[model samples]
Target chain A: MSYCVNCGVELEQSLGQCPLCNTPVINPREAVCNKSPFPEEKGQVEVVKRKDMSILLTTVMVSTSIVCGLLNVLVYSSRPWSLAVIGACILLWVILIPIAIYTRLSVYTSVLLDGLGTVIYLYMLTFLSESSQWFWGIGMPIAVLVTLVTEFLVVCFQMLPRSFLTNTLYSFTSLAALNIGMEILIDRYLQGTVQLGWSTIVLTVCIIVNITIITLLSRKRLRNAVRKRLHF
Target chain B: MAKREKPIPRKDWYQLDLSAIVYPTLHRHDFAPVYRQSVLLTEVVDPELLQRAVDLTMPRFPTYKVAMRKGLFWRYLEPNDRPGPFVQPDIKNPCQPMYFKGNNRYLIRFYYYRNRISLEAHHSLGDGTGCMCVLQTVTAVYLRLKGYPVETAFSKEQGYFVMNIDKQPDPEELEDAYMKYANAKFCPPRPGEKTYRIRGTKESFYTLNIIDGIMSTSAVLAVAKGYHATITEYLNAVLLYALLKKQESDRRLRLKPVKVAMPVNLRRFFPSKTLRNFITMIYPGVDPRLGEYTFEEIVTQVHNDMRYHINEKFLRGDITTNAATKRHPLIRIVTLFIKDFVIKLFYTRVQDHNSSAGLTNMGALKVPESMKPYIVRFDIYMGQPFSSRTNCAIISYEDTLTINFASSIIEADVERYFFRKLVQDGIHVKIESNREMTLEV
Candidate 1:
């Protein structure tokens, strides 16, 4: 018998407040009790957790490292070849820790840590090999370039308004930059000068695709047509 | 000693119908295509009596009594053969996700709270019409159990409103009607353009916020007549208009077509007594990018567009296209895992994006005169869709038409706009909801 003062809509007897507006229904003539159309306990579906997967993966990594370390000590003590297996496990753990173990860690931090772990693993290889030159010259820079490119892609995807066109633009542009950057790092490390060879063709193709995407974004009719065609 | 009874020869397995084939792949832990129909009675419900009534009515709906099973190439339905879903106390969240492992392998759930007896059915089993029939039959049986004299006699001259409980289910009731009616050779191109979606803060736990607008059926019909449109057309127009206004108020400059998807019941067009999934969606809308529209223009556009697509010819195209796609050699040869992935992709990318919102009208409900006195009103609820922020279901009893908006978002702007439009048109709307209105975005 009461109407919402703000919405001007009639309120049901069981409701203590207006559903459209949050105005409290203070009808002096009527008293509301514990009657409602819906019950009190709202059921929620259980959220699937990655804790089990994390445990399983951790067990595998730890067990493999242990078995290899044991064999290296008892059987092959001279070479200490298990370090390579241990280093590989460390790199894998670094990549999977953010994905499976501590998922709350931000993507930028995860990528940076992964790059740092790879550089450290390369340094470990310096002990087994003859020279520590490649670790600093080529390996570190390439890993850093890849990590930065991935971080940039993630930031653009998260911040930008997402669509098929924008996602494609971000991906191809990043791929082109990463491809050319890897070539330059390799050339600089080996030939003492940067020379782009295979990456030039890839850069050219990426530019054409980027220009086509920009053109589609500027025009409305073409964008709609592309959307329709790409649908499912 | 009791005499041994004969075992009936019945189907224990069935392939999912054309419309239903998509639901199994698209369902998740939080979202499934579940439809609910609840009837409010004059007296509070008795659980024991309701349970017995459900048991009595199960033989009449054989298809609804099964569970989803994964086959090698596709998922199918097999007889659940378990007791439940046991009639239990109703929860605030109706039509939540249904899992085959739990729920006694039953795809349908029955709940009672206060004076309402609700039935939630997985869309893989049936549409609104199927759920409506189940609820009506269960209610009739429940009344009978409560010492009310409700008729259950079947007759050809006077067709029964509530299905006769004693009679065995007709084979036609369990039929996959799409296969019988679809002409695979006459497939039509898929219809739908990516439309404007209502944006808002989604509920974190995926609880469906329902608001029921109860109004006089005749009053709303009279208003629709004023616009020279049917009730469905008028309501679709109102929803689109609301979305348009919401977009303008939000100051969204780049506009898309504000379309409302209406799930047309196929039983009305075909002589099928199916209780399985048999419905197709039709989108009627206005392109705001074209210009601003008055209410009259929206109504006219919705009317013509709905009428144009709701015909037998147009609907058959949808059936045929679906049937043809399923029958393709590649689709049939793929393993179940591959099929699930492809269909899930299609459902999320194409199907969910095609409509901004949905409004399904279960139309008028009829009951035997003897049973009508005990019933107060009926409410139908479309489950919250995966992407659409809001969905509406309408059903009318004697005079009251209940428009239930099941929303997944935190804001009430769409429901507010819809009911306010009706109230402004001189149709009185009494608003009720499942929860307190506290959150705003």
Candidate 2:
């Protein structure tokens, strides 16, 4: 940190002139050597880092499906279940993978992908098994709910405030609202064992308690600590 | 010499256009037109005393008051509504506001009712000092009629400010305003004693919402005196301090000097009172940027600084542009075009934040206690301050003063703030809103 020659104000960025005093910055060679050897990097401009995660996306899904298919073949040798499972995996990849990875993609794309996956999985189950009562009555709703819940939680977590407490409160509040609405929709729109079970009750209880604690913590005076970002 | 089809010469168009560019609520508030808020010494005006004053004044003036009815030679200010290209269809009519293109072609208005009187004049003709003289003369005459012994001791103070000039008043503008039954057309008659001109009331722009809590001029003076400051200095210093509390900048704030336009009566300067428009203006600006000084220190500066300028700096002949030497035909043509747009624009912006609002001391009004008890109350008329937009006018009638601020879209807080600050400074104030408007003057 160099001080301005004219006004003695601190200089932030090293491109030379100070913002407050408009004084040029100079790196005196001897002064630089006298400073600490390692310090937190200062005056760095932020840039977005693009992760090369796409190339590995399809490969991982295909390999996971193949392993499950091979396992199915070994478990049931005389049945066509193994072939069916493999077909299901290939269809899921074809329909869902692209939807999952659309960069600069919006929330609607994510929801659409979850919808497609639910339809395909449920269709396969219905066609493949006639006597499986659990899959027909309870299993289909659970599958769709799980997929939607996971996607929504992911989206909420990403969009929440950077502070830990605010983020937690936001996630809980959003999830609670989403779940209650979804429960109403499920009961009215779907039939048979439509009521929410014990797991749903447990999740709701946890969210409510956590949200209360967060709300209490978010009082006025304490919020001052969260205002450091507004200087600009 | 029965000529027809005369051209109405285009002139001073810019200064005239200033009213158009800056609306009354916004721009008019910036500059303080010279205000000498005085009281009519109405109780005692002995004729012998006034006659003595007139005798002394006449040798210098030659033609004291011009007659319109008494002389039947000059009469246009009563009302004019001809559709000239520049003359606006005089809105807020009966055109009580003086209308003057230059010398001779102008109006002098005096509004009166019972014992109260107000004098409003157009600037192109003369300055405030001249108007004040006219007001003083009118007051003296009224007191005599009401039966009072006002000694006519001739003091230079009374006639010390009138202006002397040799140029004749301009010829009548239109053949239609007055049909020349064969006189070529008389010069607009100068105000002589026989034919006195009159106008309606000059109302205070806005009704000041004064919360009168029993503070007086003496109370404020005492507080300021405690700080080794006079009334104005103490008020100005305290005002500056309050302004400092609202902002975050550590750097000292510097407001452009608050400018008050002082109209110098030219009668004393040259030695003539022909009543043919001879007045000039002076802009007195007070600097408020002394940066974190103690209240006492700031007050001392304001007191000493203002007292000095009130005499020497005022009427130094540099305030208003001198139209004498530059009254060439070519210059008038250029000025006519330029001033048509420029002067009005200049008044609009300059009058606001640069000068802010005005504080005019019309001085103590004198009257005998027996006949009329005492001078009851008086209000000084000026442009009002605009909120978030314009300026205000402050006129002091001795112990009481009116703060008039205006807004196109009025808000309650701005007025509240003005009074709040005044009360905080230990000033006794009262407010009168649109309840009592001045008729016209």
Please provide TM-scores, in order, for all candidate models, with all chains considered together. 0.77, 0.37
Q: TM-score of model 1, chain A?
A: 0.81
Best by DockQ: 1
Q: Please tell me which predicted candidate would have the highest lDDT against the true structure.
A: 1
Across A1-232, the per-residue lDDT of candidate 2 in tens digits comes to 4544543333332224432223355767414222221121221211222333544666776787778777777875555465456556656664554444444655556556656666566666654675656554456655666556667666666775556566666566556655665675566456633577643875678677685656557676655555555433
Per-residue lDDT over A1-232 for candidate 1, one digit per residue giving the tens place of the 0 to 100 score: 8898777788888888888777788888998766676899876653446788999998998999999999999998887678788888889999998988998898889888898888878777777777889989998888889889999999999899788898999999999999999999989999999878999999999999999999999999999998899866
- What C-alpha lDDT does candidate 2 achieve relative to the native structure? 0.40
How far residue B60's Cα lies from its native spot in candidate 1, in Å, is 2.6
Give me the displacement of residue A123 in model 2, in angstroms. 83
Error of 1 at A43 (Å): 2.0
Off by over 4 Å in 1: A46-232, B1-8, B155-161, B439-441
Provide candidate 2's TM-score on chain A.
0.44
